[model samples]
Target: MWQKLYEELQDQNFMIIAVAMDSRGIEAVRGPITKAKTTYTSLIDCDHVVSDLYNMVNVPQAVWINEEGRIVRPTEVSGAALSLNLKKMRKTREIYCNAIRDWVTNGEDSPHVYSDSEARAHLPSYTPDIALAHANFHLGQYLWNAGNRTEGESFMRKATDLNPNSWNFFRQMKNLGNRLGSGGPEYMARVRKRSKLGNEYYPLPDMAGMENLKK
Candidate 1:
């Protein structure tokens, strides 16, 4: 995806930089990443400081920061238009190259375009409960990945209790159960209950591999 966008913008004199939020360091990504011939700049923000600054709670979130250090669009997205390409890329695709090309060639005319208001409206609703849940979840994941399994599970359970509708949170719980069996049926039950609340937005674990969890 980065490579495609880099190519597109290279000819257009536009600069693009990808700040990776992956906890893994740049050395891990450099080998496969360097395989692409891209002209744009890219960096990794393992601590998520930049993501927090931009209020990007998820990956694939984009911000069109203008030259004046002002954010023109904070949530201009691209994945919506790449479904078919992504499907094809599943076999033989150079994602970054194609995407970069499209963006650079089309500039703002690309498939993903949004105004400031539109971007702001796309943000998560600012409910106190939800905000607190988000905080807990973030801390939980940080702790979980940092090897503080007990503390992570504690915080994650709190997060799930606050926002039972978050499939992602429950997914983490499910993973924890697999690892430590700390929170088993009870936590899994919360996942199912809340997953139902998410309806179409929620994706339950595949029954084939994870059916036992639901049982």
Candidate 2:
């Protein structure tokens, strides 16, 4: 998606500053990103600095900022062009690229231009719940790294409850459970449950598939 968007907007002077929300080092994503030759400016959020600032709850997430550095859009789904014919494409990031193209081609007419009130209205009342989940997920990461398995699992489970749609959160929950030797049977069950829910989210990548992402 970054590649497609970058290529489409390269000539239009629009910029996409991607901040990956991974705990891993940049080297982990460098190979995959390089393979795609993504030219957009990308940064690793190993410490999740940018993620916290933007209140990101998931991976493959993005914020659209204007030239003035004001956030034109918050952590919303990146717009990708819809392809009626490509229903079978797995893990399509091109949706974002398509959105970038439409914005460049149509300017204010693009769906990106929502007023503050308009944008706020689009948010579910459970947004704060999801935001809190994002925070707990980060806290879980910290606890896990600090060798507090019990506490980490507790936090991740909270995140999953707050936002069942976040497979990334559940994946972390699963990992934390596995490391603690208590998340196996239940973890497998939860993974399957979330996978079914995630299929509706489109471009559904399995827990293992997206676990390799590095910020």
Candidate 3:
């Protein structure tokens, strides 16, 4: 899916820097990337430096950077849906992909392109709790990488507790090992908890034609 998008837009100065934010490293993402045969600057972001810089909390969120190194679009749930199985998801991605094409072809003139003020308005706020969550996450990541698995995982849990809205923090910890049960009873429990807390595990993007999606 992403490969096709890259191929279509590559000639028009459009580059897709697809990043995999997996703490378990390249092995966690190698199969998918290999299967897709992606050629457009794919990378493994173990520490999630890109997410840290962009204030992303979920998978598939993306930012649009122009030739001048200016962000024309703030980070939002990207059109690169992992599964286009549902009709609604397909439509969302369709709208998103067309918007990208329109923006790339028309540049500044595209209606899909946001103005500086609009982009700024869409930027995510960095609250103190969120800041602390990131600190705990990185410290956990450092310790986990340095072979202190037990203590590292504790801090990672602290990160998630601090910012439960950040699926990145929770999901990475879940992916660290099979014992945590990334897709088991505990995972489902947390998913339900997210809903009760008014934060869907996978929230729909705030796009046109998706008004039915709960806020």
Candidate 4:
């Protein structure tokens, strides 16, 4: 979906820089990128520096930055325009794609583009606990790189305990061969819980003035 947009808008001074937050390195993401045939600027964040800077706790999140280095939109769950195997996400994909098109064509005039204060309002507050969580996560990554799996896992667990809302931290640990029980605070377990609560993992964008696009 992004590649299609990149093709369409590249001539219009629009570009997409995809950052993959995979700790296992480029080899882990090479297969998927190859399958997608993405041509835009693609980067690997082994230390999750981008994730930390953007305050992203989930995969497939996006932050729209304008040409002036301003954040037009803060981090939010981003989906492809093309439908995946998940039929339930088709409507969401359509809405998301339309919003992107509107933004691209209208620029700052687009209703989807938030003002600086509005964008900042959506960003998460960096509390001391969250800071500690990030520190622990990076420390864990360092230890894991040093071939000390035991200590790494310990720090990873502490990071998770400190910031349970961060799926990125949990995902990194899980990818590193940490197996949690089905009832544990793993990805699937959280999904199931959120489903029961009628909560959407990717909340729909506010489409107040753009109601006609729904048709």
The regions of model 3 sitting more than 4 angstroms off are 80-85, 212-215
Tens-digit lDDT track of model 3 for 106-184? 9999876789899888898878888888989999988998999999999999999988888888878877856366666
Candidate number of the best lDDT: 3
Worst 10 residues of 2 by lDDT: 206-215
Per-residue lDDT of candidate 1, residues 114-200 (tens digit):
466765665545456666776786787688778997898788789767765454455545554474332577655654564476532
Q: Each candidate's TM vs. the true structure?
A: 0.54, 0.65, 0.90, 0.84
Candidate 4 lDDT at 198 equals: 70
- Residue runs of model 4 more than 4 Å from their true location after superposition: 80-85, 178-185, 193-200, 207-215
TM-score of 2: 0.65
Residues 102-140, candidate 4: write the lDDT tens digits. 888889999889988888788767788888898899899
Candidates 3 and 4 compared by lDDT, better number: 3
What does candidate 4 score on TM?
Answer: 0.84
Better of 2 and 4 by lDDT: 4
The positional error of residue 154 in candidate 3, measured at the CA in angstroms, is: 0.9
For all candidates in order, the CA lDDT equals 0.53, 0.60, 0.82, 0.77
